[model samples]
Target chain A: MDAVRPVFYVSDGTGITAETIGHSLLTQFSGSRFQTDRLPFVDTPDRARDAANRIRAAGEAARTRPIVVTSCVDGSLTALVAESGALMLDVFAPFIEPLERELGEARQQRVGQAHGIVDFDTYHRRINAMNYALTHDDGISMNYDEADLILVGVSRAGKTPTCVYLALHHGIRAANYPLTPDDLEEERLPAKLRQHRNKLFGLTIDPIRLHQIRQERRANSRYAQLDTCKREVAQAEAMLRREGIEMLSTTHASIEEISSRVLEHLGINREMY
Target chain B: MDAVRPVFYVSDGTGITAETIGHSLLTQFSGSRFQTDRLPFVDTPDRARDAANRIRAAGEAARTRPIVVTSCVDGSLTALVAESGALMLDVFAPFIEPLERELGEARQQRVGQAHGIVDFDTYHRRINAMNYALTHDDGISMNYDEADLILVGVSRAGKTPTCVYLALHHGIRAANYPLTPDDLEEERLPAKLRQHRNKLFGLTIDPIRLHQIRQERRANSRYAQLDTCKREVAQAEAMLRREGIEMLSTTHASIEEISSRVLEHLGINREMY
Candidate 1:
């Protein structure tokens, strides 16, 4: 096994943007193993010193210069991290100058502004979307009129998480309904779902994968059997085809991917950050 | 305002990974305006042609070449997007060959692998964490034993969304409690919260900011009054200090920032992808 190298994602705010980009970069180096740590809210000189010390200690322990990916808006703090005897990758520094030149204005060097709660309207929209997803999950509420999208799938076909992700990340109101055996038996969409046909998107999965997922939750049950999963997926897919609704398979997709595809398919432009 | 550039996030599967990285890159260019579109699930040659046509149309309409950021693992689809007369930024293509060389294995050219539901364990963990956050929110449940972190703050200090973000993004089981006026009057930590002191993290905000946030939710109410907000914030900060709990201000922080800071302060390592 390759020795794990210490990797730090440092930011003056939440460090999520740094981590997201850093993780993408790290994923490309398949031979390297990384022990990642996030250091967020390092807004002060004192905190910067502490982060530098931590980075130094990590490098010493690993016997190699640690990789520090940072997105600090504060120039002094960015300089401090760069001088910490580590391989520092400043995510923001390289682009800020070019952006300033392009836009003909000075960049805001304020900490946390990039991901801050400065826009309460956007924040409330996200929260309201999340609440909507939670309330309308699993057909618990028949409030399709309020939903920007409605996902239909068999059990464990990745409906709930996708809805949650859509709601939380993009402020899109998503509701999900599980297509149960009862709904599949009739060879037709549920009455409630039929009324919101325009809002409905279907998700189908490979039976083998669906069975494996179901077995984890309910081992040895009839519902977890391969035949049951096969039948359910087939019926659900047929129903979607019959209704002329676009569908996607969740077999090899992440919640992020599923939500994005749904949005694209629905021709809904994502709300800006 | 600057003329808006057409920006396309294109992918063979879900365009989320491309969009995420592209969005981070664009954030640095604060002066430029971008009209963004997501084209997902371009797995087939026909769909790729459609995407290329769309990009061409967008560029022609804007009278400037569109910027295309893509994560299409399929070579043909990627090539098609590149030939679309746009400034192409292939996120996955630049690193795949180097990774294959380093790992001594041929890369899996599977679309959607980057954000697939291959790890059922991680999926379940995230779902479980989300359920935990929902059940334990607002001190509605005293199940702190299962909570990895409990956030305490005055009402509308941005607790619920932070908890939801932590759970959904990082699979962190977070609960939140609102520090009410009743708790502040006693000048002591709530008995239920004191028992779980080790898990507690405080969230504070500028009184004016808190008042503004509260006014949106409960307009013309005592809870939204500036004086009330000032008193509650003062009491909450003092109580957190007295209890020796680590606290962060959400006045200028994003939910991502707040969650990441909370995780960092708690010294909890996030589960890796």
Candidate 2:
């Protein structure tokens, strides 16, 4: 207990979570005697070595055991930890087993619920927004002019996350309208959004991926079927193209990339995260 | 090439960077179709599984290969990747090597710049802060009233990162002042902060850990010696106690712990990340 040592947390990307959790655990150990040196934003290889060397130096100077907690998207710190010869804890490695169990259960549950279902979570959130819009009408009509961007997507397209991410990270206000069967039959943009065609961005995903994402929330539902997901995505993309509004296929892109691409399209020079 | 699937990114934390890079990579693969899912605040094990299950389901539904790009502090998706049998690319793993090299060079260069220079980056940041404070005195004055807490420590203590983390994560503004030898001799708190004694928090680290962190930054300098580090930390702590301010030793605690504990001491509720 008297031989207290320095603890290290090396995060590969954001370093926010690993750092946060490491701090939590270290607090448990130190009670009143804990101390740490956090090195955040080590996204590049040079930065990881810097963190490793810092750990090594810290170890050499310690009269006791030194602990290093690292969080990275890649296993780049393996060598750094091996070289440092300190007590190393990789925060990410421990969660894999738990995640497996949790996912396994989710898979089984979805398989059981495969009939006549609706994605209530998604439904609820969208409904919540509609309710907000309805209540906040304030005679301040839902003008496309007030929207920074309008998202047109088929049901279960990756519109919600992108919208939320855009709003939260860049402060770009976005309104999303699902291209329901009614909208598709009408063969026109959402009536509320036709006025803001210039600000519209479309999101389309691979049918299969959309089905899987949908199934996880409500298994065995018509919405989770591959054919349904596929048809809706294709029709939605076609509609977007027909409307001549810009569209992004989100079948295999990442949120960062989509947001970046969106920002690029919108010509917005803002850091999203 | 025909069998190649579109790329995808799944993030359990902030999905900003993952999406950005994922999109770029998808474009490089010449696959115009890509997908993204941003799952933020995946703190619990169950939430992690839910995220993984969504990925697996997405893969099963895909007509092509499922290339997954993901980042998580808890490694929840490592099992997901292994079980989903997807081609997983951890973007953050490759950075440590480069970081190691840069830090080694820095240690060599800064070996004699200070006494016991642990946490070289931290030292540099603080020095930068001091420099900035010297010039930008009018910018965001961390008010004594609004500060969630204040930190008192000797030079080289881990005050800056802890404060910064608190500010960024919890919106708790933290202010820190170094207890100098002059203040010890005067037997009083720094005159600038006497009025804010109620909000003061103190930080101390073990001399050995302090020495090690210093040596990493300053290699063989006399100031990097354990004894000197100990003396300063002890003297600074003693002065803090004499002023009747409560202190936490950062000897074995992580930053998250320090911030939370400080918040707890101040009777503040910490926001969930």
lDDT of each: 0.80, 0.55
- Interface Cα RMSD for all candidates? 3.7, 20.9
CA RMSD of all predictions? 3.8, 22.0
Flag regions of model 2 displaced more than 4 Å.
Answer: A1-143, A271-273, B1-273
Interface DockQ of each model: 0.37, 0.02
Candidate 1 on B115-229: residue-level lDDT in tens?
Answer: 6545667777777787788788877787888889999999888888888788887888999999889999888899998888888899999999889878877998999999999
Model 2, position A59: C-alpha lDDT score: 71
The deviation in Å at residue B135 for candidate 2 is 47
Q: Write the per-residue lDDT of candidate 2 for residues A1-273, one digit (tens) a residue.
A: 354557665554334455544543433232224346655445566766777777888777865556676655455554555467666666545433433342232111111011112233332333233333322222134554655666678765656545544544454656667777667767677677777778878888777767866786579988788887777777777788888988887665544356656765766554322
Estimated TM-score for each candidate: 0.85, 0.34
Candidate 2 C-alpha lDDT tens digits along B102-198? 2222112111111111232342333233323222222235455645567777655667645644543444556767666566566667777788888
